[model samples]
Target: MRETIQKVGGRLAGMVIPNIGAFIAWGLITALVIPPGWLAELGIIGAETADTLTGNLVGPMLKYLLPVLIAYTGGKMVHGHRGGVLGAIAVFGVIGGAAFELSSGAAGDPPQFLGAMVIGPLAGWVMKQIDDFLEPRTPAGFEMLYNNFSQGFAGLGLTFVGYWVIGPVMSAVATAFGNMVEGITDAGLLPLADIPIEVGKVLFLNNAINHGVLTPLGTAEVAEAGKSIYFMLESNPGPGLGLLLAYWFAGSGLAKLSAPGAAIVHFFGGIHEVYFPYVLMNPVMIVAMWAGGISADIVFVATDAGLVGPPAPGSIFAYLPLLPSGGGAAGVLIGIAVGAAASFFVGSILLRMFPVKDMKDTDADADIGDALEHIPGISTV
Candidate 1:
């Protein structure tokens, strides 16, 4: 079971890790549309800027483009480009199915990220099955036509299933998950929940937790609450940021050299995967992350704070636009600061116990994913 979860987690992480640029784009667009930002503060804001950018670009990217990207990545992961195309087609159905919500009082259209996770791989697997069946019986030289049409029709069929069934069902599942979290919050148990969440993340389940659980819950909450800390709970870079910063100064050898770059990417680029290698380098760092997570959770609970929207990429800059006004913003800012401080202090202490020396065989490139080598087109990046 443990190994299975890791494999699944690794695959999901693989899909998202390659598309960090899309997250960055969404983050920037979100930041631009918010009130009282640099643009507004600088008096460059226009009445229609937010609506134009959001309606024309950000909304579609989040609602449509991102799911397809994820589906494509998942499909490509399983069976190559054909799988990718079919995966995106299947995901389109989920997105379409989600167009009508069964529940009232939702803030807006439901996010279909989880739907992407399901249908993308499903489409890939289906395509792979078709290939296995066709490869044995097809005549010579006509394989292209046979393969294209087989998968094409299969993709068309899956899209309808996605639209009519998978999408709406997944939307409900997302809503139920959100309600569960909200119930926890209402019961004052959200802070306690972070321990397991942090543990799961450090164990390579970060993508599953973020996209699978938090994003869905956060999306549903955003419809009614105007924001949710659920998104920030696991996505915050503070823990990783603090750990990397500690390594930057306290470590030696190749680790010392890599920590700075990893810190830059983890903190600003909003790609948490950069720091996974660092944590994996020293499993002890997981403790530091847990401490940070707990501290941040407590702070959020105390402040009764949340984001105006989910922070894509979950970087500090990406988080800024989503920060709620007044007390919520202050609480979030303070929580992050406190979390970083706690993590830095703890992580620095842990580093002392496991002082960095010459790089191990794998430690030479301690912060990069080895899994990338296996994925197509990943080498170029």
Candidate 2:
């Protein structure tokens, strides 16, 4: 069971890890377009242009670019370029608006990204299976046409299946997940909610939790409330930042060397993956992360610290623009400070108990392609 989970997580992480830049780009655009944000408040551009950028430009970027890129990556990981094309084609159905009805009677438009993750691999695997069967049967000169058209037709068929079938299933699941989170928030149990989030993250499930579940819910809340703490709940960098900073100052060898860069990227660039390897190197640090995460949630909940919009990449700079005007800015700052402090304090203690040791390269530190290379017939090329 453990190996199965790790394998699945590895595959899912592979899909999102390479696309971190797209997430950052979306964050930049989101920060500029939202009112009272960097571009709007700085007076660098008029409101109309910002709105146009958000609607005409940024909207498509998120709807098409990120999801297709994720699909492409997953497909490529499974069966190379042919799988990639089919995966991207299948994702169009999920991106299409009002194409299906949800179980709750809601019209499903702009399907959850979780659906993209599922359909992409499915399309890719199907293509791979077909390719395996056709390899020996195809005539030499007709190979190109046979392969291309087969994938093209398969992609087309999967697109419709994705739209009418997978989209609805994801909708119901996402809706249920959103309702659970909202219920916890309504009951003031958000701090406790951090436990599962922190655990899932360290287990290589961050993409599923963030893009799959939180993105849909956060986007909805932003549209309605102008801001949501839900976005901050899982994406806050404070906990991870604290751990990395502690590792930098009081650690040894590779961990110490990598800690500073990881902290910078996580806090400023909003690339959370930079810190994952650190935690995976020493699982005990997860307790520190959980401590910091819960503390941050406490402060955020107590002060009602909320952003005016979702911070897509969760960078400090990206986070700033989304803060609601007035007291919200201060609350956010304080919450992060407390969170980081708690994490650092706890993480430092852990470091002292089990000092970082010099170690040779191993699967724990290897990239997905390298780590999975042992599996037969599954070429990452």
Candidate 3:
């Protein structure tokens, strides 16, 4: 079972290699060059001067095109037209759904219709199958279309379709997910993210020591911002959001070690001491992290709250200032408190629900059914 699942997972990851590559390219561009220049070009921002800088075209081009292009090309490489065309449509639906929410007041359309979005891939699939009648003798009824790069043209065409026909179909689906997170986190998610900090400052030696002290001192290089793997994975407040919340508010397994560990790692360290392996010794920790991370991310983004401090290693030291500064000196501390409580609330619930073994019993059964059974969460989408 493990062997079979690995094979399938590998194949799924293989399909979205283009997007992964694009992300790497994006990192390099952001590090070596400028960051926001590209986003402004695609109307993702209102920066009128974006054309002169890398911000205008680079970010927008990649953001809009890269994802679908990756989906279509990857789908084509592995699963042929139906997979390529339809998969590309699906990718647009997810990202576009997010963007649509961000950008409202267009064509007099409502924001959250699921069927509007689902129809893009449906139409693309229909176009793909139509070949059966059009050219049954040839591959999918047409050699030229298949032989040529159908991924882009087909995907681009489907993108147009997604705008008109598909977005409405999937609006409900996207809205439901959004509403679900809003319902779950309330204001508690903010405080939960604070736990990792306390753990790191006391126990882990902290990010100040790691990112500021050790990383800079050790390396001759400047350690470009937002591009490094250290920045990419461990940069966000995602990892420890749950456990800290659990420790502080609900006191789920509220030992000194657990809460303090979350504090030291999350607060001062910004380290991903994802005690999953340890927690997975039982099982529920697996579910806890997944549900916890998702809620935390959604809440942080939705609330418009973010870390203003340097996220080099992503500790409370860096993340604190971005929160609403009401008490002047205690602003960061206040935000941390809110984030920590929320995380604990969500984490405790999830941990109790989805326990898994630390050993290799195979997450394929558990992880696969998430959306696509085989592909990776990061690589594919």
Candidate 4:
């Protein structure tokens, strides 16, 4: 069990750039940190139906559309054009479809059972087979297949199946998921007073990188980068209370680091770096990061911290540019100070207990490609 956990942890860490990003994004949306605002109100449509309906739409856009794109692009890069195309198709089918089903609930745009789940896998398999057949025939390389009419037909045919036939089904499923959250809200299972702080935490629309201060200068102006669906989630949290709870229990080690400086980063700052490297190295550290994330998510949900605005990465320094800046700014500063300190202490203790050995160049072949083997799925073969 320990070995299995270690392996899974390592894999999770390894998949960070592509798959993990999507998973984290998915978690954010699930936590309702990036929920569509109207959803909450729609429940009250009889009470505030218009608002809830609006929120439901936002949920699918963030949860389904964004993550599916990330996952598809990532998978495509890993596999190739074929891999990329199928990856998009599959992610759209499963994750997106699920989101729609969950959000809408009732008979909606696309019927669920008949489409995304079935068509998605079928498209993915066909794409994979096509890729396999086109594998580099020459001892040295794979020639360009862009001009191949037969391959093009095969690829597009699969796409036609997915987009026209399967698209709406997936959308409905995602909307249905949104509907469930609404149901909970309507039942008074979620309180209104807690909304501000709870929703404020997840900002379900924001992305992790944006929360980390990596936004390029003028990028927001030029491309509206800061306003991106992912970026918005980074700035605004979904009610991540449930997720935070899961991580707290399952990832205690990682969670303990939410100390003064570190805590601030993951919590208010939403940087998440505190446990990143640690988790990557030890793998078990993920147990903690995941726990912290899940717990924070749950709290976010409960607090109704969901707010909109460019939640500048939480820090007294970064808080300068935000609106109604003073109180939030102060809160940001205090949280960072406390969180970082707490994290330092926890990290220190863990280091003492389980010393991580420094990484070494042990590959027989020093070429970077050789390093790829250590990671899973460098090549599907």
lDDT leader = 2
What is the C-alpha lDDT profile of model 1 across 229-328, one tens digit per residue?
8888888888788888888877765556667766776788676756665565565677888788789888987887788766656689878877876558
Rank order (by TM-score, best first): 2, 1, 3, 4
Scored by CA lDDT, what does every candidate get? 0.70, 0.70, 0.39, 0.36
RMSD of each: 6.7, 6.4, 13.8, 13.2
Superposition error at 162 for model 1 (Å): 2.4
Clashes of each: 2, 0, 61, 114
lDDT per residue (tens digit) for residues 257-277 in model 4: 222333333444444322343
Q: Give the per-residue lDDT digits (tens) of candidate 2, residues 159-209.
A: 898778877675555455444444565566889777767765654345445
- Span of ten consecutive residues with least summed lDDT in model 3: 225-234
Runs of candidate 3 exceeding 4 Å displacement:
1-18, 31-54, 77-99, 102-128, 137-160, 169-286, 290-306, 309-381
Give candidate 4 regions above 4 Å deviation: 2-283, 286-318, 323-329, 351-381
Where does the lowest 10-residue lDDT sum fall in candidate 1? Answer: 359-368
lDDT of predicted model 3? 0.39
Using TM-score, give the best candidate's number. Answer: 2
TM-score of model 3 (CA atoms)? 0.40
| Winner of 2 and 3 under lDDT | 2
TM-score of 2: 0.72
- Model 3: per-residue Cα lDDT over 123-205, one tens digit each: 44555655454455555556776635454455566666665555544443333332332233334553333233232222221
